[model samples]
Target: MDWAKDGRDWPNNEHSRFVACRPHRWHVQAAGEGPVLLLLHGAGGATQSFRDLLPLLARRFTVVAPDLPGQGFTSLGTRQRCGLAPMAEDIARLCEENGWRPHHIVGHSAGGAIALQLALHWPVKSVVCLNGALGTFEGLAGWLFPVLAKLLAMNPLVPRLFARLSSTEKRVSDLLASTGSQIDPRGVGLYRRLVADRAHVEGTLLMMAQWRVEGLMSRLDRISAPVLFLTAENDRSVPPATSVLAAAKVQDGEIVELPGLGHLAHEEAPERVAEEILAFIDRIETKKPPKVSGGS
Candidate 1:
């Protein structure tokens, strides 16, 4: 589905939404009814991450997954670093494009960061963060990746070199592989080929690094929307400690850690995440009991 490669059509119906949108379009997959469930995939992920769960979730809500600009089939419209402000604005645009105003949101990994930004800055009703990469990394491997990314990110020749030396398919496949073997193979293949522009890849890395310095952590308290943060007990990317810190910050928030799951909590534990999400909605919707005639 390297549409950017030969400008070929994407492989699946889900991928076609992206194809139909074409240049300057962000990839999307939509289903079900009621207030939209705006899904934001991780930096390395495409909309396909929610493929299996969408059908089930769609049974209850109108689920829509948007491949963030620079990820999947979406076009990274600028060569400059794609910061959170621009990213959040595009999310607001996607919502306006689809007429999904005042929607609910669910984001995983880097998407979680975007989701948080949306809730704080946009007209979102509520949000669910799945194994989000909000706080700083803890491990030696985590510290090392950013240090390595810094050297490579600034190299103007690096993007072209990777694009020529390696197939875009090959580079993206490497990203899918990083998530773990549990990810759907077909979905991974589609994601790997969605964006042929290596510059976009470098932009993603730059955006992540910027977050490390900009520090959105302190400002999360300003987000007034109710939040349910889902964490993975075994998540290797963002630690449970990070989610714990976030839960304490958001005024109306709770954290539920999925036991034994990894970074991709929804993929590794879809039903559990879905159930919790539905329950949260239920609680929110049940604010007032059925009307009863009363005389005082």
Candidate 2:
């Protein structure tokens, strides 16, 4: 996406910055001050996905939200790195280079998988997943979805064709509705801008084609950080049972259901989501052994 044209009215525009992290130039937005909290949006979404949630979380923590490589304002270097493991590794390096040690991670959908992958190596205190796409497709979908995505990604003309077809306001609204979420006009507008851009569309397709969740699911027990799977009852994109089953595998995982909400639960009700996150973090802190001072 063109920052000059498309990002003119971007949410939290003042906090946005471009950082060259080798192989990719990342666009990250940081605000407030305290322990770092990294916010990762799902595939096809940008930093704007956290426009409301970021400020609320920033009230108590240093919040950092970045557009994944090849999506949003971030330019992609290696197209193949859009996969789960590589994305996590690249993000870890990005954080280390920028001196941002995330005390906690809050990821939406596919971002949730990346968060778990990061926790495998990074020492984050906790992780929160909002309507995470934690499970693979069942039966025929499991075999067909990735294959179809790969074929689409391989076609150079597909992105432009998709962007053209999906650029209308009605189309964007329909797409969001398909997720069983009803967002405001502003939210719809942002998504429209994304779909209007061929690069964003291509990047999203590439990520979808390369994404693999089985590896992460198999190693959930290895993650030491406490994880909270915030599932939305009305979510049509990913069933709430996905989180229910995935949480059972984590050594320190818990599941919370958001009633009457959908796949984009955070966007639908940022305040409520923030409350759950803050409450979860508080619980984690309270469980920690208190610090002891040495005698002078």
Candidate 3:
């Protein structure tokens, strides 16, 4: 009943509204009251992924949870490129529309890359990433598997296989179930419902096709925002060390490790994740990072 495409089950989420951006009617779930905190989910997720952690983060800052284009209820454009730039652009638009100025962005996995890109390009005050991949780094063979996943994603054969996934309902459920044992009933259903459409299939595959973020790693130094790199002990999805490396590059970055949590640290360990984000926000509001003048 909750998984229906129609707006029958949405009101229960609270701070609910319908915002039309283009191809789809984006379902927004806004709650709490404070500074802006835009939460971005990974490739295979919707706003539902942030269910457990949103309320906590919302305590210290307002949360704008919008399903990315083609991931949740949002739709893709006529001719779209599903990479970091476009995704970040869309997020910027969302922030602007919701009056979420001077916000902070938190991204996970693909969302993490998008968050980094957003931090570089969008008007955000700060950014924090959890278990994200910088698979675009040059000569980083250790992440060869993820890099190869990005490469193989562009193959013509992939769209065919990915497109067919939506036709069968059981396949979708099984895919989401593979993530964790005691999956959230609501989350499992949402994940299944989201990928059941062909357009969603196209949007997802396009992201896979355009999976190239490492090209912008060098430009990260240009990003002056304070970033927090939070990773789990041993995340199989996005290498934890990859995050550590990126953190070291940021002039004023802080890194925190949550022991024994999985790739989805926000959900696996929401309280700890919330605490770190709250601390990061306090740091940013205090003062700007150190700067070198043009006369140097």
Superposed on all Cα atoms, the candidates' RMSDs to the truth, in angstroms, are 6.5, 5.8, 6.5
Highest TM-score among the candidates is held by which one?
A: 2
Question: Clash number for every model?
Answer: 0, 0, 1
What is candidate 1's lDDT per residue for 1-296, written digit by digit as tens? 25556335343344346532322466677778887888788764666677666677788888878766666566666644356666777777767766876568888887888889888777677888887778665444266447646766677666455445545665555544444424566555555543345755555555655555145677888888888778776666678788788889888777775776667667756777788777766766776331232100
Model 1 TM-score relative to the real fold:
0.79
lDDT of 3 by residue, 202-239 (tens): 56656665667776688778778888887776466566
* C-alpha lDDT of all candidate models, in order: 0.66, 0.87, 0.67
lDDT score for residue 106 of model 3: 87
Range of the 10 consecutive residues with the lowest summed lDDT in candidate 3: 136-145
Candidate 2 lDDT by residue in tens digits, 1-296: 99899778999999999999977999999999999999999988999899999999999999989899888999998888989999999999999999999999999998988888999988899999888878764333345447647678577788888799878999888878878889999999999999899888888878888888888989899999999889888888888889888889888887888888888889999999999899889979998532232100
- Assess every candidate by TM-score: 0.79, 0.93, 0.78
Q: Give the lDDT ranking, best first.
A: 2, 3, 1
Residue-level lDDT for 240 in candidate 3:
69
Better of 1 and 3 by TM-score: 1
Query: Against the true structure, whose lDDT is highest?
Result: 2
